[model samples]
Target: MEAAGCSYQFRIALLGDAGVGKTSLLRCYVTGAQGAAEPDPEPTVGVEFYSRALQLPAGLRVKLQLWDTAGQECFRCITRSFYRNMVGVLLVFDVTNRESFEHIQAWHQEVVSTQGPDKVVFLLVGHKCDLSTRCVSSQEAEELAASLGMGFMETSAKSNCNVDLAFNTVTSAIEQALQQGDI
Candidate 1:
């Protein structure tokens, strides 16, 4: 349900390779508890949704609708269909997995081609950052994000680090676009 006085609505999607912590991040953010009775997560079959109402400091309340998509290649056909109405995207990759990071470009291209390049704001996310052996560095992720004209952030759903900041950064960008008539 929307907050009592919310005036704006935003739809965002999480996209990445399978096992990149998309669902973990979503659960952590929406529930505010990482492991309380958390069940073993099976691979997402297609798409799942979660939403929260956020009241920004500027007094602009936004209901954020989050779409969490299946990352396996077989499910891309289903996930791509949901990309049409997204105003923002979280392009996530596992910091411990270099292959996932390598596929970021293809994922970005799919979303941009489906939603129109300038229509949605993209945020490159390096997930699973709490792991000790990281294959993808922050510098590398930052460089890629910059080259794509997007913002980059690292988050660890397991530890709940930077999760709120990542989501807030995307929402703030969306709100800014809305205020500027860009969305």
Candidate 2:
């Protein structure tokens, strides 16, 4: 929604299994600093909110309301509630963990059932690309994203790889949807 003349805001959510580096990705994208991924990064308890104003390619200033949700089962109820308001979502998965990658479907389904599929734009983010033991191959991730009609990108929150691009990708999709009256 427009906050003032020539300025608009959209709500976006980051979802994935626990320890997928959602927080780290947000930190990297917002702060332009790496190492947000601590050795023992605290698991998100419920939901954390972040905001940043960005100038879109179309030359519009956009405010992004980023909601980082807890991935644990215990917080599912809490996190699910926040999905309805999100116009875009970054469905993240750890590249090093196969289970996290497999859980992408469930997370996407949750958001779809809660928010309605067509109202929200989805981007599949494969995090932890800096790790050498990558369990989820880019081909597999891209296939899954394609099956779900979403775009895919690999990012390393530790090294700040594609952090901005991931956010920008989803935001650009949101902008396109707005133009097409999809949201």
Candidate 3:
């Protein structure tokens, strides 16, 4: 919905398996800081929110609410509750871990079942692209995005590779959706 002073606020959620660099991506995009290389970082207990204002193509100022959810099973109920309000969902997967990439489908299905198909903009992001030991190839990610009708990109929170592009891409999609009254 539109915020005060000609600004539109869009709520976006980051979803994936645990330890998939979701927090790192958020910190990189929102705070412009390189996230620490720590494992687990204590599983996200509930939903965490961060806001950033981005100027869109048509001179529209959009405020993005990046919601980072706990990937653990126990918090599924809490995370699921926020799904209805999300205008965009970034299905992030760790490039170094094959299982996280494989789980993208399940996460997509969950989003669809809970939030419906038309209201949510879906993006597939492969995190940790700077890691030399990549487990999931670009071809696989492209194919999955094509099969699911979503956009795909690789990002490195450490190197800041495609990190801004990924977030900007989703925000642009959300802006288009809002302009067309899809959200």
- Kindly indicate the candidate among 1 and 2 with the higher lDDT: 1
Clash pairs detected, candidate 3: none
Q: Which stretches of candidate 3 lie over 4 Å from their true place?
A: 1-6, 36-41
Better of 1 and 2 by TM-score: 1
Models sorted by lDDT, best on top: 1, 2, 3
Candidates 2 and 3 compared by TM-score, better number: 2
Estimate the TM-score for candidate 2. 0.94
Model 3: per-residue Cα lDDT over 25-142, one tens digit each:
8988887876555343565778888888777889898788889998888888989999988899999999999999999999999999998878799999999988999999999999
Q: Lowest-scoring 10 consecutive residues by lDDT in candidate 3?
A: 34-43
Please report, as a residue range, the 10-residue window in candidate 1 with the lowest summed lDDT: 33-42
Give the alpha-carbon lDDT of every model: 0.92, 0.90, 0.88
Is candidate 1 or 3 superior in lDDT?
Answer: 1
TM-score of each: 0.95, 0.94, 0.92
- Which tens-of-lDDT digit does each residue in 1-183 have in candidate 2? 343544778999999999999988887787788874456458889999888888888888899999989989999999988987789999999999999999999999998888787999999999999999999999999999999999999999788888999999999999999999998
Ranking by TM-score: 1, 2, 3
Q: Which candidate should be chosen as best, given TM-score against the real structure?
A: 1
